[model samples]
Structures are given as C-alpha cells and as structure tokens.
Target: MPKIALHNRDGSSNGTVDLDDAVFDVAVNVPAMHQVVTAQLAAARSGTSKTKSRGEVRGGGKKPWRQKGTGRARQGSIRSPQWSGGGIAHGPSGEQNHVKRVNKKLKRVALRSALSDRARSGDVRVVDDLVFEAPRTKDALAFLDALEIGSRRVLVVMAARDQVTGRSFRNLRRVHLLTVDQLNTYDVLVSDVVIFQRAALDHIGKGSRPDLGQRGRRPSAGTRSDDADLGQRGRRPSAGSRSDDADLVLTGREQE
Candidate 1:
C-alpha cells in the first residue's frame, strides 16, 4: 500500500491517505500506455487533410495535344500527376479513418500503470475536496499556489461535479480539472503533478492503508475462490468499478 500527504486548500497538511495498490502500485506498462494514448488522440483528429487525385482535378477533360504527333513526349491530360499543376498522386484523402481501438480491460491496466508510476515518482497528491463558494479565477490560482504548483501543469481529479471548482481552475491554462470519470492516462502522464480530491478517491478507491478505512487490498494470491476462475482470465477486473477505460493512451495526445 502507498500513502500520500493530504493537504488543505491553504497549503497545510491535513493528514494522509492510502492509494490502492491496484491503481497506484502496479508496474508501469509503457507499451500499453502508448497504444491507448495513440488511439485516444487519433479519435480527436478530424482526418480532414485532403488532396485531389488526377481524375478528380478540373480541366483534365481536354488532352493538351495529339499523343502520336506530340514532339516533346506522349501526352495525356494536363492534370496528370507528372505535370507541375497536376493533381497529387498517392496523397492524403480527407476520408481516412484515424481511429484505433484499444481493449477496455487493457486500457484500465495501462491507466493504473501510469498512475502507479506517478505515485512512485512522488507526483501524486491528495487534497480536501475543492469547493468554491463561487467561481473565481484568483481563488483557483491561489489554491494552486497553496499546493505549491502555482505555475506547474497539474491534473486535478474531482469526485463529483463542482461547477464552481471547474470555473475557478478553467482560467489557469496549465491546470486541467476533470471529474473522476474523465480521469485518463494521457492527462495523468503529461502533468507534473496529479492531485485527487479526498472524496474523489471514493470513485477511484483511495486504496489507502487499512487504518484509513476498508482494507482496500485485492484478495491475496494465497486465497482462491471457486468463482475466481469464472471471471475473465489474464485481466485484473476493474474490481467492478466504472468502465471508464480509455479508447486510446498517451502516445501522441500531447499535440494539444
């Protein structure tokens, strides 16, 4: 089990929380993360890059000269690919399908791998719920300053909707705020620090040390239930958690 120092919005340490080993103690899967991130970013691409083929170009209906008598060379339409102003050959079409698919189960594993890496690198932090009486950019800035990430890029995970919190952080270009459901490997890997609201841990499971609450441990390897074999083999179930696996991982997502 791993633990992080919990802090108040004002820069003071409140206590500590345990992180779920399943979520933040697993080995980093670079290949899996790369695959998922690449797919996710591909989905965002408009894939609108386009070029006209020779057949599609205008004014190609007329042949420049008689092919048999042409002195320079045999000629077809002026719009042929060999010509200076001719349509492109083997160029990009606007209809390309850039999307790639990643398995839901593999995506989760990759996400956990990324989060675990962050934990190991000492970039994961926990904070009291970020609630704002009203949305204020200054307050958001101040809040981040308190966390000592005033100018650092950060990923904040909220357990639930908090419009005020969203508004406050929205003004900070470097701070990305997302609900627990929106949490993904791309954001977690790109940011300098990953912060989670105390309540948000419930959604992702604090996986904290037992003293914090439930013994958030997976069944020991020594203990095998009869139904264990019935579940999917070779995949760590999200433990019946939300199916928020990413369609892609972090390979090219940083283009934004």
Candidate 2:
C-alpha cells in the first residue's frame, strides 16, 4: 500500500494514512490515460459550427445562364460551389458529434494510473480536514503558504458538504477546487500537486471502484482480513463483510 503523511490545516504533521492500493498503487497506464484524456477533451467541444451547403444557400433557385449560351462552363446557379459566394461543399454540419466513447474500465484505469503517477512523484498530499469558519481568500492563501504550495497549480479535492473550503479556495488563481465526485484523470494530471481532505480520500478509496463491492460503505474492523485477502487474490471482498452506514462510527473512532 502507498502511505502518505497526513497534515493538519495549518500544515503540521499529524500522522500518516495508507492509501488504497486499488486507487493509488496501480501500475501507471500511459496509453489508457492518453486515450481517456483525449476523449474527455473531445467531449467538451461544442460541435455547433455549421456551414451552409450548396443546396441550402440562398439565391440558388434561378440558373445564372442557359446550358450552352453563355459559354461559361454551362452556368447552373449564382450560388453554385464554383461561384465566389458559393456554399461550402464538405463542411461541418452543426450536428457532428465529437464525443468519443471510452470504456468505463479504461476510464477507471486511467484515473488510477494518473493518481498513482502523482503519488509516486510525491505530488499527492492529504490533509486531516479543512473546516473553515467562513470563506476568506486571505485564510486560503495562508493555508497554501503553510503547506508551501507556492504558485504551483494545485488541485484540492474536498467533500461535497464542505462548501466553505471550496469558496475559500476559489479565489486563488493557482488553486483548482473540486468535489470528490468531480475528480478525474485530466484534472489530476494537469495539477502540480493534489491535496485531498481525509474524508474525501477515504470516500474515493471506497467508492471509486465499484467492482470492489465497497461502495458507500466502510470496511469494519472485522473485515480487514477479508480486504487483505481480496487484495491478494485480485478480487472483491464479500459484500456481506462490509458494514453499511459505518462511516460516522469509523470516523469518530479514528479521530479519537
């Protein structure tokens, strides 16, 4: 398992946390990451560019000249493709689809590969929590200063409920804030460093891989053995072994 130092909001060393092997220790897949990133960028295109075709252009109804009288290559219409103001022959039709379909498994692999690459490079940081009293850009800047994250593009992943942190970080030009649900390969790869709140990291480890059978649930103390065994066997832990609604219980115990 990959272990990273956990820090407090003021950048003091608290302890360390073991990252999920499935999410942050996978072998990096460059090709898969490239493909997924390409698809993601392609999907963002609006594909709304359209050019009028020859048939759709106005003033094409009346033929400019008779078949052979004009001796001008038998003029068809003023708006013919050969004319100066002619419509485009083969151009974008506004309905063109630029979206590329990538397999869900490939996307997951790419994301994990990106995160693993960052982890290996020591660009991943985990913070215990970010409980801001209010949204203040000054406090956000101080937080970054404390973390020594000077000017470098940083990706901050926080829980959805932590809107205060989101707002606090939004004013920093170099800081990109995203909820855990919005985390993806492109954003992770583009950032110089990635900071994850402890709760968000736990949620990602448990929920990102649906195949692990740990979605929306925390592994109870009793299921640690099963998790280890599944990790060794390259399979999912038994569903019966996980305890639903255990997040609050586990969080309180861990904090204590």
Candidate 3:
C-alpha cells in the first residue's frame, strides 16, 4: 500500500490515507500508457476535415480547353489538381476514422500504470474534502496556493456529485477537474500533480480494479432484482391464484 499525505481544503495537514497498492504501487507499463494515451488523443479528433476533389468541384463541368490543337499542353477541367484554386488531390475526405481500438483490460492497465508512475514521482496528493458553500473561484485558487501547487497543471479528482467544487475549479486555466469516473491514462499522464478528494480515493480503493465500479456488478435503481421480480409477477399470475380462480369458476358454473 502506498500512503499519501492528506490535507484539508485550506492545505492543513490531516494525517494520511493508504492508497490501494493495485492502483498506486503497481509496476508502471510505459508501452501500455503510451498506447492508451495515443488512443485517447486520437479519439478526440473530430475527423471532419475535408477537401473537394476535381470531380466534386463546382466548375469542373466545363473543360479549360480542347484536348488537342492548343499551343499549351492539353487541359481538362479548370478544377483539375494542377490548376490554381483547383480541387485538392489525395486529401482528407471527412470520413477519416482516427479512433484507435484498445481493449478494456489494456485501458485499465494503462490507467493504473500512469497512476503508479505519478505516485512514484510523489505527484499524487490527497485532500480531506472540497466542500464549498458556493462556487467561488477565489477560494479554489486559494486552495491551490495553499498546497503550493504554483502554475503547474493540476488534476483534481472528486466525486461526481460534488458540483459546487467542480464549478469553483472550472474557471482556473491550469486546474483540470474530473470526476473519479472520468479519470484516465491520458489525463493522468499529462498532469503535473494529481489531487484526489478523500472520498474519491476511498471509492477507488474499494474497487478491485481501476474501472471495476463502472462494470455494473450491482444493479442500479429501476434495475434491481426486486424490480425484476415485480415485473415477472405483473406479467404472469401465480399458480396458486390460477388454481383458486379455476375452482371459483367451476363452483359458479355448478350453481348456474
């Protein structure tokens, strides 16, 4: 287990917390991190860049000159690639797929590797909490200043429900706010320091793996076992009820 110094919102020391060895003390895999980070960056591309080919250009319907009997070399459409202001050749067609496929296990390994690297470099910090009465940019800055985190790129990981803290840090230029669920290899590798809320750290530690919490091991609201049972009951009457109804119907027929 790797232990990191814990701090209050005001930067006061508040004991320490043990980070999960699986997450923070594992062997760093550089190649896995590189592949994951590359894939992440590739996925962010819009891939919408496009260029018009000669055939698709507006003015290409008319040829520039006859194919022969001209002093100059024969010419085709004015929109040919050789002509100025003409359509581009072999250019992007707006259908590019820059996304690289990385397996879930590889992604997890990469994230853990990045985190372990950061932890070994002593760039990981834990804060007790980031409760904010209101969204205050000044308070956010003060928190960073108290931690002596200067102008470096700081990645703050917090619980998803902490909207107030997120709002406070959103305006900071170098401070990136991400929920625990959004933590990934690229963000972790690009950051100079990682600040984890105590709650977020505990949540990560409770999981067996980096992304285990998101794997839907337990059913969520509206999808519980009880709900499924209720759905089954609503769809079909019980055997006892059917037998009782049949007996009642037979007795009614006998009386009739």
Candidate 4:
C-alpha cells in the first residue's frame, strides 16, 4: 500500500502513513455488509415491547348479572374485554422486549466491511489536518461546504478529538463528528461520505481490528480451554505438622 500524506490547513504535510491492504483492500460486498449491519442494528434494539392479554389486565372480577333469566344477553364480569373500562383483550403493554442477537465476530466484520466499502467508493475524504479558528458552527459549516458535503450526512473521522471541531459540528444535524476510536458500523454505513484527518488514519486503522475466524468462537484471554493450562496445579500440604504438635504436647504433659 502507498503511504498517503496528511496535511494542515495551509496544505502543509502533517505526516505520511501507510494503510494495510487487509484492513482496507477487501472488495465491498454490499449484500453481505447490508445483512451484517442490519443484524447488528436489530440486536441493539431494546425489544421491550409487550401486549396485555385479557387475563393480564386489571378488573373484571365479579359477574355483572345473573347468567340466565335476563331480557338482555347474558352478562359476565363488567371488566370483560368487550365492555367499556374493562380489561383489554389484547392491548400493547410496555413489557415487550425487541432485543435481538448478533454474533460478536459478525459485528466486527460488518464494521470493517463498511470501512472498506467507503474507501472503495471514493467517498473517503482525507484531510491532512483540521483547524478551527473559533468554536463556531460556521467554521464547521465552512469545512463541510469546502468538502462539498452540504445537505448530506457526513462522518467526520478525527485521530483523537478536536473539541473545537466537535463543538462546532454539534448542532448540525447533517454532520456527525466521530473520533477515529469511536467509529462504528451504523454511522459509517449511514453516512454519504467519510471525512477523516490524515493523521487520524492510523488511529482509525488501529481501532479497526477485524473479527477473524468463526462468528461465535472469538478466542480471548478470559476464555477457558481444554488444551491450555491456565494456572498452577493444586499441591498437598506437609504431612508431619500434626505429629510434631502431638509430641510437643506429650512432652509438656510429662514435665508437668
């Protein structure tokens, strides 16, 4: 991979950095990336929605009238779902849970895939450096205008944080500033283009660790395995301590 030079406001070079092909070279697979991104977003939902069944609702304890001998239709409990102020037959309750699950590896891959897609699409705008004269939205708006990103959602990727830049873009609904460390699949996928600082590319790439191998089995230091020995084996205590104590006690008794 070629080293890309990053710059300052005056078009001065900040530094040149190289990007790994493995991280940024993968062909963009829209279908696979879309599936993975959708799954991740679905998993993040609270899913805590619930509908109240007839029995779950309050009231409707006593029958309204006798079951027979009435001119009107037979009457049951006043709280019946069919009656007003009665228990709801099937009303939405607040308890319904909408949370879904996505494999950890899948989540990581989706993010990397999105980044690769952005890079391939030529939608990545790399700035050598970022400058803000003051903490104003106008300064932020000017940068967006210069970058030709007006009226579109842009993901501004910075190496660390530029508080001035952050504050400047905070109020702009169309612009989102994400530190390289904070970039995620949803934001990357949602944006029309990704604008990143040149110096921030290394930081972004460093944070973009691919979730290699199978989706479910991500090996970590915390995981236990049959093939690995994690700690020292248990050992027996010294065996002669009790006998020595017994002898000392006997000797004391004899002396007394």
TM-scores of the candidates in the order shown: 0.77, 0.73, 0.77, 0.63
Better of 1 and 2 by lDDT: 2
What does the lDDT read for residue 20 in candidate 3? Answer: 78
Candidate 2 residues lying further than 4 Å off, grouped into runs, are 60-75, 207-256
Q: Assess candidate 3 and give its lDDT.
A: 0.66
Please rank every candidate by TM-score, starting with the best. Answer: 1, 3, 2, 4
Worst 10 residues of 2 by lDDT: 227-236
Model 4 per-residue lDDT tens digits across residues 29-67 = 576556655644454444455655657668667887788
Output the lDDT of residue 164, model 1: 70
By lDDT, who's the top model here?
Answer: 2
Minimal lDDT window, size 10, model 3: 228-237
Q: How close is each model in CA RMSD to the real structure?
A: 12.9, 12.7, 18.0, 20.9
Deviation (Å) of 197 in candidate 2? 0.3
lDDT of 4 at 167: 69
Cα lDDT for residue 43, candidate 2: 60
lDDT of 2 by residue, 48-145 (tens): 79999888998878877788766578777888787888988898999987767776666667777888899999989999977688888799898888
What is candidate 2's TM-score against the reference? Answer: 0.73
- Give one digit per residue, the lDDT tens place, for model 1 in 1-256: 7888989988799888878766778888899989877766665566679999998888878878887855778778999999988999999999887767776777877788888898999888898868888889898788888888757678877665566777676656577665565567666777789988888775566322112221112222222223311112232222212224422221212111
Q: How far in Å is the alpha carbon of 27 misplaced in model 1? A: 0.6
Q: By TM-score, is 1 or 2 better? A: 1
Q: What is the C-alpha lDDT of each candidate?
A: 0.66, 0.67, 0.66, 0.54
